[model samples]
Target chain A: MSAPKALRQPASLRLVSAAFLAFWCLIAAFPIFWIAVMSIKVPIDAFAANPLDVILGPLTKAQGDGLSLLGIVAWIGFLWLTFRVCTRLLPALVSRHAPFGSAALGWLIAALAAGVLFVLLGFGVLVPLVRALDGALGLEPLIGLTTQHYQAVWVENAFWRNFVNSMIVTGGVVTVSLTVGTLAGYGLARSGSNLAFWILIVALVFRALPHSVLVAGYLPVFINSAEILRPILGDAAPTLYGQPLAVIAVLVAINQPFTIWMLRSFFQNIPADLDEAARVDGCTHFQAFRWVIMPVMWPGVITTGLFSFLLAYNDFLVTSLLLDASNQTMVPAIASYFNRETTTTDQVEAVAAAVSITAPLFLLVMVFQRQIVSGLTAGAVKG
Target chain B: MKFKTFAAFVAPSMFMMFLFIAAPLVSVFLQSFYLTQPVRVATEIETCTPGFTGQVCKTETKFLPQLDENGKVITETTFVGLESYRNVVQPDHAWAAISSFDWRGLMNIDFWKALRFTLTFTLLTLPLVIGVGLALALAVNNAARSIRGPVIFISLLPFIITPVIGALSIRWLFVGDGILTRLMEAYSGQDIAMFAQAWTIELLMLFYRVWHVAPFAFVIFYAGLQTVNTDSLEAAVIDGATRFERLRYVIVPHLMPLIVFVALIHLMDAYRVFEEVVGFRSQAHVISLQWLTYDFLEPDDAGNRSISRASASAMLTMIGIVILLVPLLRKTWRDHKGAH
Candidate 1:
């Protein structure tokens, strides 16, 4: 016997839940908020470590000297919590008989209100906090908010090349994993063979290893590949080290087992009769696969492909290992940036870098949100 | 199609796996056995193979025992069986141990301590990742489908960042004169040195690490949540079950497989943590096996005692994972069975 939803619903229950949600959302959005705030600060106001001063014309050291960035963030966090609690509490307390339209309208108004509050905090609380601290500490902030960070982050040849590198590697991984894993999956799903099971286990083992350890192990291969290839292919031996293809190979290999598992599930849901029917119609196994099985597997393939791309694109340990100094990925370069000497390092620039890198992919996920969601649930729910 | 033709259709991919994945992996294990360095292996190959016409290779697999006691040459050559393993376990043997104050002690911690910390890091990270992660996942899942992609993408940003960058950013967040320090001093009129206490430092590191990684878990969990039986929830609710009960009886059981899988991944990753450890640079060291490997790279930092301890540590870590993985795999297998 479980507690009824109505029975457990204390007057403050919604309030607390809403508050927790707000706090989590605030925590989640902190870095982005900090970045957007720092972006608007004048050069002198953003870089300073403390005694930060806000520049709205002439600036004053932030009032109530006991304020900390954590406190400020905490304060904002509390405010968010308050807003969430009040809205939920008030709405529930106000009326049970309110029209559905009125309730929906209330919900929309609250959401919009929350959105505006967050934006204001990002602009209002965060910027001044960074600025006033800089002023108080006598540290010069990185002056002027501009599109330079975005331009530098995305417009640079390195960024574009890295993007291309990601595409190539990720594409290769998806292709290889999909093709190989699909066939293996077909065997695993159709025959339910132990070999397929074993294959999947091995693939999982390989993929599951600390990627860094795998990257370290791969050092030997990258180092020795030149020699390994020369004898077999002679002078025309295609150099593989630091090539996007290497990443592709690694991604394909890493993704293979997972792909197999996913494809197997997708294939299992598909009736063998369909496969059999296609076979009876003068279709060779390959022909039937191309004409029959491939189409049915589209949903799985699309999901897997997107995942593979993201994995490859985001892969740091491997890229850091295999890629040379000249060919860094977005992740490693950002990782390495802290080691570099920046002229008045803007926190916002770093934030902007973070944002720009994630924005495109996030948008893609947004656009095809249903597919990703379905993909996750699809595998899990089958159990 | 006949079974044989089906096999034919599968052969290309299988062959590719065998040639590329299986063979290279095997070769890595074999390389571990060879006596010489990687460079020596490559260079020695062309001249040394007994029968090969192409690149031939030879190795001095035996050690001269002429150095009787502390290199007081009074003996002849002797065959050493698995001495590397012996040497690695007792890092005090073979090479003068790394004792450099600046660089030593990263990897050269007792094999046991390193193992303990590795497991601790994994266990510590697990709840933070899964609990908060599940919440984030559910939130994003329930968010307007319009924002789902954008929110998820933003959330997982840390995952794609190189560990170096990820860890560095974390360090920046908590270090003295860091955002946290600045923030704390402003609010409480107290300076919080994040790195002074092991637990304090560990907590911060744990928080940052989980923050960075939870999104990956979120994405996966969110995906899993979508496939959960909505009808079961409706039924549970109609039958008067609350959210907590519903989650436990219905949603949780549904998510068990992913939970196990995610845990397994985090376990493996935590054992070999490196880039972040270096970046964090806290005084209270949560030494991991990787630190040992990195220590070996800069020998004489740990008194050049020997490479034995580090190697022993590495081997032991592998063995531990092998030991722990069995039960976890059993659970996964059982769940996998039940799921199907």
Candidate 2:
């Protein structure tokens, strides 16, 4: 780790670099931190004229919605436990089971189990226990805190429906794109033909297309889909315009090019010897891919799947344009919350919804930070 | 692999791409030239109302769209042949404004206005993202090893957050009596509204984009740093190279291809900036090419949409991306050829 004589930085340069990095870390993370604070307070406190007032939340405390000292300790403990479970326990459990002997499936089961356990403990156990402790101790409110906005957003406004829709679209996209992309990528990686190169290039171009343009292309056809399908389905044909299925199809198409390109690079990294060894046993190509290459390909497949999940989950244009109001995904749903006229309470709820949308992404990054970073750098490095 | 096997393996993905991406592109290209409008017939209708104690009757002509047997509006499509493009660009007005050197006049046009913002936003953020990202990478490289993991984790949060949500969070921080604005107003002792004017909103958009994208650059450059040849650094030091000189010559040259890679990706993503416009609600003062197309395609209450114009705008946007990408793509092509 020793630096070369000329490569060594001066003390002042090191100091400045440290300061700059700290500043950047602040700039990068402050907004999320700030908004999470804003989401839990009364409107007056959230939008206070003085920044300290927003943080201290005096008005919110006066409104009888403050957190007691005990409550704060309990909540902090709960959060720390959750973090420990996600980063420590979950990984250990996942590795122990290796459920189905597949890394992807093991992680999936662990993540689901963690989520369900989190809900049950946080709502079913912690809240009631905290209230009981407060009553027993006769403690007064200390600092302001409220879950009313979150309650309004998730329950009254039924943001859970949007959450469900987002899951369906994202799940469909990840499953289909990965299933299709892995095969094509493996095929292209194995083939050294000019046609394979050309197909890869075309896919790169397709990857750069703005989603809006694609949405524009799909709109008219979607609007006329019933008529187009009538000849085959005999009068029961359904319009695809407003269905989540339509969005899943379009997102899969939009995601495929990148998926193929990434997975192709990953497949290329594996030596040709292993697959050749498998083929020497007189196995079919698909059989070799399934039985030999795939077990080794799990890491790459998981990385690529994380990206496809992000793209489909975070999408606004395709989901917003293709799906109608009732079927709206979370991103577009949050946008619609802003599109309407807003009362202050409604605006706070919007902030709550915005904060809620970020929770799953935060968890994903926490668990898969290494894979995500590698996924990003993988494409650039090879290029 | 055999040809049949390759084809079989790639068939599903190729079919999806053909049906969705390639076909839609063709459809968009053709759609830009054709305009579809509901067929409206002018009919005289008698309206009777009680007015001032007596029934008053008046005959008025109204245009109503004709519907067919299935309760669907009858429509006709006609080839307009560049009319939609002309409508979008407004060449006559653009030319007049350009000839007179009237930048304001040009900015008043929706297409020109959007193009101006989109280009400025894209081009301006490119260097900033690279610079900031490189600096962050260098900083982390120079820091104590124990802290890099936490620093990298915190830095990645911004990039992974949903783009609209990211923009919305920033907006809430500064929109109306938000914390940042309140602090600014307090320090400056002047009333300040970030969203009330074009310049501030534009600045925020630029800042937000750089903030959102710099981590991507950092991760790539950091990975690049791992592969930097220490032998070259030792040779440079023996040759009496200064710290900056080593970075300027040995380090940057090694990272040139990566710089181009980041720039290319940034150009493609930034050209279609739409989330900021929605999240900031800056349509009154700021709009982007993607937003303009969306506005055109959104159906009005009368069930009317300017599909041709939307298609033309979308096509123009795609062309812009291609044009911006040409230099980078050519470099990539050269590298590919050289490698082979």
Candidate 3:
């Protein structure tokens, strides 16, 4: 509203808003934080003990099984050194920007104070209590941290195969969808025809269809095609039943409608004069698209490509139904980890696998947060 | 552009759309009317044994695959008409339940149980998602500049997580000896098993849906907020309008289109809920139409799949989507005509 007077809301309202935002922020981030922590913890610590206790508890004698007293001392000394460096160096860096940066200095001091509290809690209270309890009750180590679960999932579980399958499928989908969708979207945007309009409408309708519905239709066709081809192809014919190509084809088809719509809007934003200008320069429509429009449309193409990759990468229904056991992608592979046959230890490994799959996506989102946010809003707001 | 050039450009997408999308739809419709299985026939096998008096002969009836003269196993596909659909809807059973005044009997039917939950899940979460999302948009819009970026990123994390992972995360929190379960038990001084009951699981699923989808609505609403007419807002403020009055009068009307857009998308997505049922392992308690189709496709003890029933269920799901989409389609058609 640009009302300067309205900006000066009461302090109470501002405080309430801040508190509310903080509460929701915790709710949004805590599960991920919890999973990250659980992923690194030893299996016993992960499943046997409460998560809060594991985070807050000190190292018991059993937890210190592989460690020497000297190691503990070194850890304490390292923490102290880190605390001193942050307290001394951070304030100096802050004061250069503002002459009176007392708030910055206060924040630095508060952070250091929290570090001191954690050290005291870890060593003085938690360690002694755990050691005493262990000595009295002969209790085993209840909490310990290790990266072994990640290693096990990577090596013993052959997760690399699933990761590669996901990459191949996603790569195939992104390339195929972008290429075909761009052509179609450009056509629909530049050519004002009844046929193009009808095609766009049909694409919209198809886009609304659920993935399971499509999968249901594909099952019979794939099975029948495999049988029909068996006499000619011999032993290789059955590959169609669980082949990655079949899954990729379906993924591209399902994703094409959305991709086309997104690209159409993007293409529409580029003025038609550009195409006319190129035509006047003796270039055909395809030539104009390849040489002139594409460069200008690169950002939109990339955004659409990212969305396509997400569709293929994140899909479960098609991949699970189409791909056999050995060919399962990461989502379905991780799903297979959850069953009645698995024990608590396996559950820990499953959680670790979940973390493994999510970490890369988290990093990707962090890197492309702006693009993803814009792409998501582009459809709804424009419509 | 000429029609030839346009066709050349769009041919690939058109071919794919026809092959995979349009054809599959037609195939699904046709498949709903046909049932395929191995052909079986009764055959007689004779056994003779030498006895003290004479040779005793016995004939036994056995079921065998029907074979032609070429010795190839015969498979039969027959026109089922509306039989598969009848099996799914169970109209006779539904009538019995209704006439006998047995509401529980209706719930016992898989189709109705799944339908009741699916509708409840979709319709109930609509208002909650929109309300929470709009509230979040308003809050984040007012948040300090330095903090807004991080807040938005954190809020979007829930939505960004894969649907299965998101559902599982919530399930883990409430499952036996999980953190939230432990906390609740500790706080109330009583043992509570969240997954042991139907209502709790349904409640958690509803909560999860809101948590996972509100970010989408928030993003749309936030974008809409940026386009609000400043002149009108200023005029309202000058007329001594309070914050709530200004919001209701100016901002709400401005965001109405975006609200409808989000609602349409959400309805389409929520209608075919599947991942949550699988992720929560709630098949024992709750199911959806999509899951019902998948269930029908699962092989039984004899390794025979109910493809006919699955096709019927898939068709039913599409019908539901088409019904929900009719209003939106009508509006779109009207807009198209007006623009022309």
Candidate 4:
């Protein structure tokens, strides 16, 4: 492929692109960043230090040192200007290839930006860490950073139970959906009948069906099932309504279509000759799938499993409707923090719970970023 | 393959799908035609009261659930035949309100209100999500290689987060005394209560929807961008086409099918918006058809649920989705046939 002339073009375009990317990066990162920051601050401190006020308020009257609010605001403004300059102007200057220019100036600007970032990080994160450590060490704490909210959410509010419930539900749904869906997808891929085509089409339509429609149908069935089972199981009958299994079943049902769609394509990519070769060795079809196919299908299975876990873990509508209070998953459990009956004092704890729920997913994205990107675009974009 | 082998392979999935998906669909349709209510009977009670002359006997009438021989209350499910649909759409009431020029009355109907919001929300956000997603893809496409991976991972964060949590996060930013809200107040010098009004809440919900889902579109467009033929791009570039022109002529056309794909997914998903309403707790101001169905299913103080109404609403929501999906499905069918 020849390099497009635009790639060798003016530095201005690259500068603009850099700045534009930086702006979007900030937009994407700020909310989570702000949430993380606010999660550590005391409730009063969190609400008091408004961004606008911090940027524009008057300064003075310090206890430790007489630093004016103006000083802090000015420092922040200077950092902001420096960041903008480094991202926008310095790129153009460096890319122009002037004498003693590109490499040295680029390094200089990077160092400057790094310095500013360190300062911002110190104020935003490190200070809080130090304060928490100070409190733990039985010393005078200069800032408010306590894990009491995390404790309150985990212990007093019983979010630990909800977290465990979410794990069980997600685990069950992912396992069941992948196991059943892979088999179905393999069958469809290998079949010569037109029924397979129609089934795929039908599954697509089912995937498009609103979750509420299905949940509405399940409502009566589950209720009746519980009623009928009461005579046999007595106290255990609540499992139908108030258990992870019911939620897991519905989740798997809803998730199967996408799982099958993804896996069908994955199976299609493998050479059919390999399976035939296995069969020639006196291996049964299931045995071929088990030994020959499954080994090569690991990557696809992992991708599908990730999505299945996401579906079960992230779902709100079905989980909230199907599972009773004692068995609610993390999404619905965190939402319960906002219920009208809960006191306003629990707001900080609610934020903490939100952070708790998001932490694992953030880690997942970090660890499996490559697979996730590929998995997301796999079905939508085709050659 | 033998039929028996195929059956053995496919039976589990088919059974689950049939039981859960097909059966419920049929039940929802059937339920739309029936009205399930408590069986009621009129009973008379004679009472003796001292009046001016002597004890006067009076009879009082009361309606109560009729009981069976075993003393269990029986629920009567009568096949009302489209009555539930009529009750929801309220054709007569709508016409009356329209003729009377009662604008408020027209909006007062829960179905119309929900329909209005649903249509507006779905239609309005479609182009924005597409546009923003395309822009991000373009920008990230041109970004330096070292930064590209991290940018994508960051962009995907919003899409990957749980939908409910994503909405809550944004809501927290703009709710009472939230960081963004406080910032706005401090900047504008006025208290801006974001969730207090209908339009504000709707706007926030729309914004949140875009923020949460645009990453999905970005990932799709970015993938589509990779497959754009480089020879065509080089030819366009050699022809002295500006970046915009190249994108307009060469790039977008290549990505057209993917744009349609994303649109189909978005329209189907957005038309049945429920999670946002639940997450934002905006049902009082902006209820959707999906929420309406859930609302109907919620048990009343007497521990009785309006299952018939919920089923009706569910059926209606499905019809709306089917209507939205017809064009896409037809196109897919045509393409399938063409391939054949």
Candidate 5:
């Protein structure tokens, strides 16, 4: 097509477009907005009677329509400001004292925020919707909040135990998935042809199975394994049946495929000549991978690893079915607290559990704010 | 040395995959076929008669013989043909659906409604996600460093965060008494039950879905945007093309491959639509095929009748979606192939 005349624009137009895009982004990121606000509101103020009225500007209960829209805007602005202040200071803290420059802390915080943001999404959104039906027809939340839901959940060694269960499950899956997916991806990158195509199809299909079926199919096998596995390391053998290991096993099995597919795409981006150069320099292929290829693929590996770690940690169905009641993860605990009869005080804790689950993750996102936005979509645009 | 070198490079991951993945999947498929066999009975029937049914059988008719008082044979139950599969296929025949009262859920109205609700939900959500995703990709891809990192990070945070928190926090935000509704009531001057109203719920669901996936959309498009031929873009810019013209004739046409790639991934994930809907839907039966599969697997007396029907429904949804998107995927991929 031939060039068209340019529209004359002042520099302000570009600035306006930037502002408009930022505004749309804030709207799209509603939970993140709710999160920073909820974090600081002091729980009592968060749920005080007539709680919605407290928002600034047009959001006073006196004016409802413009109130909500402005409330949303105000909420977004509030959260962005917090992020700005936090971001500005964090690098300073790290740079000023290099000794505390712990890289893993960023990952931990991101995971925590992931847990927090998710819980807020569910309770702030799902349970209330269910309860609203009750309210609309003159009813109450299905499981209203209570101090007891938190108490019941907290007092139960089971609930705390499940958090450990999830960690083990997520950790096992991540380790196994990365080990296998990375290798398989490397294999595919070097393979001659069509098997790679078939494998990619397999990777995608497994990535897409409803875990309900996967877990259901697993139940009987696990239940029946007591007799056969008793001999392996004796009756005390870390049985796969109902263990957190079972949950992680399925997760590793299910999730490994996708990263294999993703890493394959990025692995291809690594030049073949790098391996040749390493060989010419007299490094064995093993040395080449350890010294060269693996390091080159580290960023891809790290991104893929982080994604898989989050997926495993966030998963509900696999962990729930294979795990016993005492073994429930954060998702199931959050679901159970609401689904079971909960009182209002318990409701806050349920929301608390939700926030606590993803809080560290949000912190991670703040740290990696640079890499995530860049590579987050990398697989999609190319793969 | 080179061949051994290549072999060495690939060993660890390959060994791990075989032991963990291929082993389990093959083993599970084999196991799904075998029901838990009762080589030895847990308890034999106590006495002179056959069986009663439902609540009556195990409680009231407990002591009857393998043959009931009526002498109808009762105690033993064993392997049946894709009996579970058959249940979902001919759901009417299986006992009333196990999930609802009185078996009425078998011909699940809630299931179908959820399916329909999901359709409308996806229709509303996808555009917002894709639109916002692409817009961010275009705008940020052109911006300075000051605005880029933070904007894209927050934009993409929803995608990277674990779904447990991500999904729930989102649900909480728009809940009926949620911050969103409370704000809506204050702003609108009329109390709107954000989750209680159908249109409002639809809007809320769409809004959350967009927020949840918009990051993915932005990330994918941004990734593609990185690969764009800047020289090609500069040539168009130098030629005096308008911004819209550049987007249309230059950027969009150029990003066709990425667009198709984004659309395919979104279409696949969107139709699955479980985590988002599960977070949002509790009141009205919002029908979607994924939820229907979930409903099918809810609970049955003997075992869940899932394999065929759940797979069947999923397969059907996939087929339907593919049929719809095939032309687009093909047209876009084909057009963009040689150029990329």
Candidate 6:
């Protein structure tokens, strides 16, 4: 539809707005883009005094460690293919072949399979293929690109263990919080009692609490947990401090309030008529929620799940304070790299690790942009 | 829904929240009033060490924590009502500095220094984020329809990236001849160090937070813009209103509630600003309330933490947030009552 005559913007206004938008987008995206570029080059090139030298990486080329034109093309093609497959083909395949009651289960399996496939293709097939092509062509390097920092971070420094720890923590947090939150949110949404309103008010207050206070309270108890559990479990009781389970528990608690609030708003958007009809058809309350409401709630669940995943994945204060050195998550592990004395190579590795952690987030945003945006506006617009 | 079923449905969530959040809050409150310290006893010991000629034996008296039979340190806890808070606030020292009008002296105190930066960071970034977010929304609204998706996708990157990582990205760009610092130096024909001083570091922090959060506000405002009454806008234009007049009168008034919502969320989040302090390694030059608590609780070489002080600091931080949130809470309460 065309804008009304008065609503249409003048050319100058449109130009200014476009320019402002371009400037804002650059301010928003440039740091991420620059960091990814810096992570691939050698430290000398990455941290060069001249921005052009950093980009061109002549010193890296002189060091004989840079990507050829063919190598760059292969890498881009592989990444694009992976993105397309994971975002489109995989989800479609999972949903189609999934059993009637197990689509979520199917998606989980598919996601894991896709992850494994990506690792295998990138490292197993593509690395070797690129090396062979570059060797055969004997072409000059086009731009600096090195995986040495990534290799050091993931292999030499055992950063994969941290990545695994992060997965476990985030996974547990999202699963538990979503399961609990959906129930509470639905209950609160359907219940119009004074008690429900009070509960929600309390939850809002709880949600505003800074996490440090919670960590402070948990610290002493966790440190002495072995003794606390000794009477029931005898001498076999384990200390809760520094365990991934402890971090998960704390994160789930921290995330519950916001989760319930978001899910409640989403549940309210779904008319009560649907579930009321189910109830009239002889489905019990629980059954109505299960067989009728839940299927329609998947979009909302997925959106809330994305947020829970981000909170648990991106946490620093709780993980850094509570987790043991061996059980540190990716964010805290990267922070630890800067805590101690470090060489130029070590700093570059930290940058590599930083870039690696953001890859999963980038993919999530790419696939679920609409859901994330809607979820953000849902509360403000409706409530 | 019946009360019985509602209780059953919410049982697990309530239990977890009560167990983790409510109990911890109570404990933190109580802990602030109590101090725990290891019992120290003076003991005489002889140490023999290798010297230049022969083994040297020296006798010395040392005060060390007493360990129990199980190899755990013996500790004592005492009720010291409000003492920890006093220690944290340092009322006497603060009063002396204030009476003398020694602004620098007051800032030399850790808590005051942190409070200064935290408050300034929160308040200064508020308007900038709202302004940028509104401009972005208006821009995107007026843009060609085909490009809005790409523009939004690119803009959301800063919001979704981990906060600490975002801070680190800015830190890397400007720390020690990084790309931005080099560019500025080249343009100005002078050397620059962004992290060397307080003001520059604080400025970068404000910029980073605004960049990180404006997208969230933008998305909200953009959604709000979609529902703006086009009829009113057309009428305003017929009335000979300029573009600025239209925005100020029509668009902004419509987005007011959303602005308040964004402001409330920003206040709650920004008051606890700890990540930038950690990510930028700004403890030497700047700190925040949350960082102060963490610092107090961080173990030193002796494996001792000032748990009471940390608790007190945490309580203070919570109180500050509650104070800031009081107005919003009151408004919500009134709205709830009206709805009822």
TM-score of chain A of 3: 0.76
Give candidate 6 regions above 4 Å deviation: A78-115, B44-62
Report, to 2 decimal places, the DockQ of model 4. 0.59
Model 1 — TM-score against the truth? 0.68
lDDT of 1 by residue, B202-297 (tens): 676677678777876777787788778866777888898876898789988988888876676677666666655655655246656666554442
Q: Let me know the TM-score candidate 4 reaches against the reference structure.
A: 0.85
List DockQ, one per candidate, in order: 0.17, 0.80, 0.57, 0.59, 0.28, 0.82
Candidate 2 per-residue lDDT, tens place, A1-383, comes to: 67655667789999999999889888988999988999999988889887778877898989888778998899899988988888778777877879443998888777777778888998899888988889899988888888889999999889999999999999999999999999999999999876788788889889888888888899999989999899999789889999988888899999999999999989989898988898999988999999888888888998999999999999988888888898899999997788773777778889999999998888888778788999998899985
Cα-based RMSD of the predictions, in order?
Answer: 13.2, 1.8, 8.9, 9.5, 10.3, 2.3
Question: How many clashing residue pairs are found in candidate 2?
Answer: 0
- TM-score of model number 6: 0.96
TM accuracy, model 2: 0.97
Compared with the true structure, what per-residue lDDT tens digits does model 3 show for residues A1-383?
A: 34477545778877888888888888888877787766666555554336665453333224554223434454567556644544354444544543342332343344445455655865577566656655776655543455567778889989889988988888888888888999999999898887887788788789888777777788877877867788999867765668888887888899888998898888988999999999999999899998889877866786787788777887878888888788789998987788742676677788888887776566445544666788888787776
Clashing pairs in 3: none
Query: lDDT tens string, model 4, A63-146?
Result: 221223333444467646654554455555644653331243343344445555645774576555544554566553233344
The model with the greatest DockQ is 6
Clash pairs for candidate 2: none
lDDT tens digits, residues B1-340, model 5? 3345334534554454455555544554443333433233234443344547533333233333344567544433344545434433455543455444544454344444555666666566667777877887877865776777667666766776656566567666665556766777778888666556566656655666677787777777777777778677678878977777877987777677766666666666666666655565454535456656555545457554443344444444545555655575466447545444
Off by over 4 Å in 3: A1-3, A56-143, A229-239, B44-60, B66-73
Chain A (alone) TM-scores for all candidate structures: 0.68, 0.95, 0.76, 0.74, 0.69, 0.93
TM-score of each: 0.68, 0.97, 0.86, 0.85, 0.72, 0.96
Worst 10 residues of 1 chain B by lDDT: B37-46
Q: After superposition, how far is residue B16 of candidate 4 from its true place, in Å?
A: 1.2
Q: What's the C-alpha lDDT at position A228 in model 2?
A: 89
Residue B153 Cα positional deviation in candidate 6, in Å, after optimal superposition: 1.4
- Model 5, A199-282: lDDT tens digits are 555555555555554554555457557656777757775546567766776777777677777788788889989988998999
